[model samples]
Target: MPVIEIENLRKTYSMDGGLSVEALCGVSLCFESGEFAAIMGASGSGKSTLLNILGCLDPPTAGRYLLNDDNVAALEGERLAALRNENIGFVFQSFNLLSRTSALENTELPLMYNHSGLGMTEIRRRALAALDRVGLAERADHHPNQLSGGQQQRVALARALVNEPSVLLADEPTGNLDSRTTLDIMALLQQLNDQGMLIVMVTHEQEIGAYTRRILEMRDGLIIRDSPVENRRHARAEASGESTTRLNATES
Candidate 1:
């Protein structure tokens, strides 16, 4: 079964003044494990709307969304929330870190929120490990303001991975950083993909999207182009000496 599925997903919003806007008309796609895909579009192209639905942050007005073969669009209440927490990791363009908390605290927030059975010691350990994955272990004691834009983003990425989700969804992750920092974050994401993490990113920059195995261009709430880079797995494998980099994702 496909890890993620979206079929004819539709979303429409009605404003207070009775203005109805159709964000997504009818879109369909499927994502498999260990795939790194980029979704790109211009403003008002419904990229964010589609991403929200895929991440379970919002519901579509009409659609068939299956996360691990379960109809996520049909789930409600705690079931929906639990599925989201268990299967998805989210990263935003802005490094959404708390102001006064240490990086370790921020990374542990997910496990602390849903998995209260874990002792603080274990949470701290896993949090630090996630920090190490992003090469931010030394900065685990630092707060958001103390780190560079790239470092802060890495902290956020660590927080997302601390839960060990099936898919990592990033929305405009490089929007706030400089060119150098953007490249650094992209490299980190490349490394994560190499580690067999399924990643779906929304970006406006073509250069950043080039790093992914697949590029999905969305326009008017539909996927217009879905193209894969030739030899993407080979490119990834040569980047690191890790068995995870050898894993390949299968699409339906």
Candidate 2:
């Protein structure tokens, strides 16, 4: 079964004078396990709105969304929050780490909301493992202020991973990093996806989107093009100064 399934998803916003704006217009998509996909569009194209709905941050005005076959489109309050915490992990552009919290502590915060009954030792162990996966284990004791942008983002990624969520949702995760650091983060994300983590990312940068396996181009609240990347860029190879070649979509 697909990790995520949405059918005719719609989201509208109320404006002044009893007017409304349709942010999403019957958008439907599915993402399977281990798939790494990117959503790209210009400003006001509804990519952010779509991501918000997917992340469980907002409910769709209409339609169905199934995460691992559970209907979550209309879930609200504690139920929605619980479902989000249990099944989805989020990484944002701002690296939303607590200012004074240590990396390990920040990574452990998600577990506080978990009802799994895991003890502190197990929680710390999982957090450390997640940090190690992101190559930040050595920095676990450091605060966000003491780390570089890339390092802080890794901590954010580790925090997102600590819950072992079924789907990883990233919104402009590389937006604040330099090109080189962005490549590093993409490489890490690719590795995780290779290990069977479903990753959905929103990016406006074509260069960044090239790192993913599939691209969905959005326009005016609809996906205009959905195609597999013919010439998927390998960040490890790119970081080593290799010349990359592009292929036609049919070649994929």
Candidate 3:
């Protein structure tokens, strides 16, 4: 099933004068359930604009956006906020964790805003479980400063997963990590994707993009290329210095 669908989506930003910048230009796309895909482009290519609209952080100036079969453009105010909180999860390049809070507490931040009637006990339990999924349960009490960059990103990922969202959106998720740590993070992501979590990531690096099952390259506010990986990178295999199969890319 298609969890996300956008048709002729457009976004524009107005300037002081009678002028505007079109960030997204009549872009149409669909993401099915359990799909692992990446959006790639240089600066000003509208990849971020499209991601914002999909995550419900911004509304399109024109066109339809459907999330889990609901028309997202039709929602406003609290309704939109609720939809975003309930179904979409986000991870950023910065790791975005609070400096003062413990890893568990950082993961609990999303649930705090949800108002789902979950008690503190239940919330903590869920948060801990999320941390455990990312292999950081033992360090739950550690502050951001105490954790390494990769561990911090794991906390961020756990926070995103705590809500049981329909899809996970990551923007340059490993941009701050070293190469070895990048592989570790990507391995965790691959494990999650294997277990049927839908993931869409935005990255400028082709090597990082190679880990995903599909790649969508955007340019000038349009998707110039949409191709499936004939041979997707297996994070664990590469991490162990084992050979990974690669097939020729065929257009989709």
Candidate 4:
């Protein structure tokens, strides 16, 4: 069975005139284990809506969502929160780190809520390991303000993975970074995907989408196309005598 499933999921936002704006119009999808996926769409194209539902941060208006075969649409309140905390990790474009906390402390925050019996020492150990995975272990003691934007983002990503959730949901992860930092983060995500982590990312940029195995494109609250990367695309770029620049690992 797929690790995640959605059946006819729909969400509508009601306006003042009793008119409704449908954000997701009964979209259905399933995610396989360890697959790297890119969710791409124009603005107002339901990418955020779909992501929000999948992350368990928002409920669908009408449809069935089965995550790990459990009826997610039927879950509510603390049940939904517990399920989300246990099964999903999120990396946002804004790098929403606590302003006053160190990187290690920020990464350790989630474990404090995981109900684990491990003490603070174990939590720090695990958080450091997660930071190492994202190549941010050296910045463990740095607060968000003390780090560069890219470094802060890496710290936020470390916090997301510290719990080892089943799915990693990233919304515009590279949107705020320069091109170089974007590739570094993309490479890190690729490495994680290769190591059997399921990743679902939302992006409007084709460069970032190229790193994923599959792309789901949306428009006007509907999925327009679901496809694999076209070989011709790479061929065309190469034909134009273009070269891709690599991100400097040490920058972040």
Candidate 5:
């Protein structure tokens, strides 16, 4: 079964003067387990709107979204929040770390929302493990201001992974990083995908999109192009100054 499945997903915003602007006009998509996919588009192309719905941050105006076969539209209030916390992990462009908190504390934020009744020791252990996965275990006690941009982003990634979510959602996660750091983060994302964690990312940069196995381009609230990357760029190779090449062609 697909990890995520959406059928005719639609979202519209009611603006001033009884005007309604459609953000997503019947987008249908399916993401399988272990897939590394990128959503690409220009500004106002609805990519962000789709990501919001997928992250459970917003509800679609119409249609169905199934996460692990649970009807997302059917969940409400605390149940929806719980579902999102349990299954969806989010990383954003801004890093979104609490500057006053330590890396380990930032990572434990997600678990704090969890209703599983976990003890503090267990939460700390999971947070530390998550930081280790993102190569930031040694910086567990460092505050956000003490870390570099890339390191801060890694902290955000660690926070996302601390929940052991079924899927990782990243919105322009590398936007604030330099080119070198961009590749570094992409390499980490690739490694996570290789380890069987499903990842869906939003990026407008063509070069950045090439690092993913699949790219879906949206325009005017619709996915105009959904194709497997013909020449996937391996971030590890790029980071190591080695040329890499791979080819495949498939369409969604």
Candidate 6:
């Protein structure tokens, strides 16, 4: 079954003078387990809106949205929050780590809220494991300010993954990083996806989108193109100074 399924999804915001702005217009898509997909668009193209809905941060104005076969569009309040915490992991452009907190503590925040049944020892164990997954186990005691941009982002990713969520939602996760750091982050994301994690990322840069298996191009609140990437760039290969070119140059 698909990890995510949406049909004719729509979202609108009320404006002045009794007007409304359509942020999403009849959007529909499905994402399977272990698939890596990118959503790309210019500002006002509805990509952010789509990501917000996908992350369960907002409800759709109309339509069906299913996460792991559960109808999220019909849920509200704590039920929705529980579903989000249980099934989804989020990474934002900003690392969103607490300045004064240690990386391990920051990564433990999610569990504190939703997994209260877990003891402190288990929480610490899981958080440490998560940091290890992101290649930051040794830095677990360091604060966000002590880490580089890429390392901070890795901490954020570790926090997102600590719960072992079924799907990962990244909203411009590499937007604040330099080119080399961006490639490092992409390589990490790709590695996670290869391990059966479903990833859906929002990015405006075509170069960043090239690393994903599929790209969904949005324009004016609609998907203009939903196509497979012919020669998906491998970040590890790129990092090793290998040529990263499309198998079919015309695929884009």
- Between 4 and 5, whose lDDT is larger? 5
TM-score of every candidate relative to the true structure: 0.89, 0.94, 0.94, 0.90, 0.95, 0.94
Evaluate residue 78 in candidate 1 and report its C-alpha lDDT on the 0 to 100 scale: 81
Report RMSD for candidate 6.
Answer: 5.3
Whole-model alpha-carbon lDDT for candidate 3: 0.92
Candidate 6's TM-score: 0.94
Give all candidates' CA lDDT scores.
0.87, 0.92, 0.92, 0.87, 0.94, 0.93
Question: Per-residue CA lDDT of candidate 3, range 5-109, in tens?
Answer: 999999998988889998988999999877899999998999999998999999999999999999999987788888877898899999999999999999998
Worst 10 residues of 5 by lDDT: 243-252
Better of 3 and 4 by TM-score: 3
- What overall lDDT, based on C-alpha atoms, would model 6 receive against the true structure? 0.93
In model 5, what is the error at residue 1, expressed in angstroms? 0.9
Per-residue CA lDDT of model 1 for 180-208, tens digit only, reads 67767887898898888999999998877
Q: What lDDT tens digits, residue by residue, belong to model 2 across residues 220-249?
A: 999999999888999877765632333333
lDDT of 4 by residue, 1-252 (tens): 698989889999999989999999989898988988899999999999999999999999999998888899999778888777778989999989999899999999888888556698899999999999989999899989999888888998898899988899999999999865776677788778888989999999987898888899999888889997654123223323323322333344
Where does candidate 6 have its weakest 10-residue lDDT segment?
242-251
lDDT of 5 by residue, 101-128 (tens): 9999999999999999789999999999
Candidate 6, 26-117: lDDT as tens digits: 99999999999999999999999999999999999999999988899988778878877778899999988899999999999888777458
Indicate the residue-level lDDT of 130 in model 4.
96
Q: Report model 4's TM-score to 2 decimal places.
A: 0.90
Off by over 4 Å in 6: 242-252
The candidate that wins on lDDT is 5
Q: Each model's RMSD to truth, in Å?
A: 7.4, 5.7, 6.0, 4.7, 6.2, 5.3
lDDT of 1: 0.87
